[model samples]
Target: MADNEFQSFLTELRRGSLTLAVLGCLQESYYGYGLLQAMREKLIDIEANTLYPLLRRLESQGLLLSQWDTSESRPRKYYEISEKGRLVYKELLAEWRKMQSSIDSICGEGEEDERFN
Candidate 1:
């Protein structure tokens, strides 16, 4: 595949996983920039543009809770996962593990077949 095509495939693969990652990270409260920095620290390459909209969407979906803190010179909106979000995150994690196990099994089978050939 062309470089752009490979990038497109990679982006699609990261989409769902990104949601799970965001939900997992928001177990603690973080403002937009803080959350972005934290995710980057963990080697998750998410753009600010993508993260903001997703935060809004998750908040709107009742999967997250947001509060504004004005103690500092500037006010920032902080987000944390709700109880519902924790439940959903657990479910998604389970599903991801199951999918990963199946993929691993298939790849192991492929390796075995290669050894026979």
Candidate 2:
């Protein structure tokens, strides 16, 4: 595959998981930059432009709750997963495990078959 094509495929693969990852991280409240740093620390690479839009969308979807903190010199908005987000995250996590198991089984079978051949 061309490098660009491969990158496109990789982006598509990461897109679906981004929501789940964000929701998981948002279980604890965090501001935009703080969330981005936390995700990077956990090896989940995301850009600020992408994360900011996603946070807004999740809040609009009622999956997240946000509060503005003006205690500091600069005001910052903190986000946390709402109750609905928690339920959705649980369901998504279960589905992700199921899909991962199925993929693993298929790959393992292919490896076993290759050894036999």
Cα lDDT, all candidates? 0.96, 0.95
Q: Which stretches of candidate 2 lie over 4 Å from their true place?
A: 109-117
lDDT by residue (1-117, candidate 2, tens digit) is 899999889889989799999999999999999999999999998989999999999999999999999999999999999999999999999999898889878787578668889
Against the hidden reference, what TM-scores do the models get? 0.89, 0.89
Worst 10 residues of 2 by lDDT: 104-113
Instruction: Give Cα distance to truth, residue 107, candidate 1, Å.
Output: 2.0
Question: On a 0 to 100 scale, what is the lDDT of residue 109 in model 2?
Answer: 52
User: Over the full model, what C-alpha lDDT does candidate 1 score relative to the true structure?
Assistant: 0.96
- Candidate 1 lDDT over 49-113, as tens digits, reads 99999999999999999999999999999999999999999999999999988987878757866
Model 1 worst lDDT window (10 residues): 104-113
| lDDT at residue 84 of model 2 (Cα atoms) | 97
Clashing pairs in 2: none
